[model samples]
Target: RVDFTKIVEEQKSLREDFNKLREDFNKMLLEISELKKGYGRLERRIESTFNAMISGLTDLSKYAGLTLEDFTRKILENYLKGMGVLPSDRSLRSETIDSEQIDIFCEDPAIVGEVTAYAESTKEAEKLLKKASVVRQKLGKEPKKYLLVMTTNKQVYKDIQKISEENEIELIVGRVV
Candidate 1:
């Protein structure tokens, strides 16, 4: 016979796990709050111009279950498909963590998705641009699918525009994080 108390204990364990998850989530929220303290400068500048460019929730609590990379890849894949740039069959590559790292690589077209994910700092943005350049160089003189750099930071968009025009790289940026 099944021990009914054992089932009750199992339920208690599940509740404890959920409670731990909530604590972790709240901790992440505090971290994000601290990071965003001085990031709103450009946000204020572009408030008028890209008012419509930014859509969706300013607070991302609904996505608490998702990691930054997961969130970025999903948003990117959907955004590319939405922009009619990438094929619907394309999926993000995640397993390989190589020196020449790429977030998502399209198999058929061989496009590389190098997302910056810089909500505050532009260091990640710069690194992605450099990596994308190196990847392009490694495949020199061959036609390649676009290497997209996606970021939520407003400041990076300016840099992206300048770089795209200079190097002829394609970039897709979502306005609101």
Candidate 2:
């Protein structure tokens, strides 16, 4: 006599295994999707690196475009006037340092503030650090904090945070507008 009932149970086990295989396939598909996403990110990094390595950018504004000094002045004036950071007793001299300018120079009771503003770029973090170093050297004592405002792009917010944390400097960015 053939054990048909036992054969049916084996078939049921085989069907369960098939379902498990389908779930594994779906998991593999998700992993593949994630890998593709990561690869695309890497491709973008390579492209940006290549562009950075290229020559100077052409001027559309005929050399009348926004300069770093202009940006620094605007940001400092707004912060001092609107934010009450500037003092009437002492003159406020705002300048951009090659390094983070040792934040302390910006904080002297008589010195008002030292700020560096940029339009935001890959070079921002490095520039901020440089300003910090200069401020430190100039002040002999570290300033309370370094204020960095970027009018160019807010995409570098995370980068600003990272550098600020690493250097223990206060980094502020301009609004998206």
Candidate 3:
């Protein structure tokens, strides 16, 4: 016959093990909660940092009276410079190519860019296409052509996208205030 006392002892041991497991699970939950809190704090800090940077940039823009077009032009120039265009090449001092105001023209990478504040009409895309054609003629048929617009509606943006694709122009939209 089996010893009933031994069976009772085994049950007690099992209960102890289950209690320990419950305690460990609770501890893990608490640790996860603490980690979530820490992550929340980190996320807020990052958001605040970006907001401050944007505010600083906005203040500088206001001080310089930079319109949307001007701001976009500046961004294009900086982007070209970042792409390895020299300061002298990216300078606005360069004469307007073909008696038309070309936005950004870098000889090294052979890129010509145009900046517009708004592109809400199909006519805008057409004009940009014409400009790209001229730039291609000047910079050669294979040079990179870009049109950077500050804002556009969804429908108009689609139109512009089609035109750019057909004309082999890179249409970039900048979401800037």
Tens-place lDDT per residue, model 3, 1-177, is 268988999999999999999999999999999999999999768645543553455446667888644665565566556766546444432236677666666555566666666676767656655655676777675556777665677788888778888878767764323
lDDT of the structure predicted as candidate 3: 0.66
Give lDDT tens digits, candidate 1, residues 8-84.
Answer: 99999999999999999999999898778656766555543433332232125146676545665676567668767
Clashing pairs in 1: none
Candidate 2 matches the true fold with a TM-score of 0.39
TM-scores for all candidates: the values are 0.47, 0.39, 0.52
Q: How close is candidate 3 to the true structure, as a TM-score?
A: 0.52
lDDT of 2 by residue, 81-110 (tens): 565665644334455455333322344542
lDDT of 3 at 123: 70
Specify the poorest-scoring 10-residue window by lDDT in model 1.
50-59
Best by TM-score: 3
Which ten residues in a row are the worst by lDDT in model 3? 86-95
lDDT of each: 0.55, 0.52, 0.66
Give the runs in model 1 whose Cα sits over 4 Å from its true position. Answer: 1-64, 95-98, 119-122, 137-157, 173-177
Candidates in descending lDDT order? 3, 1, 2
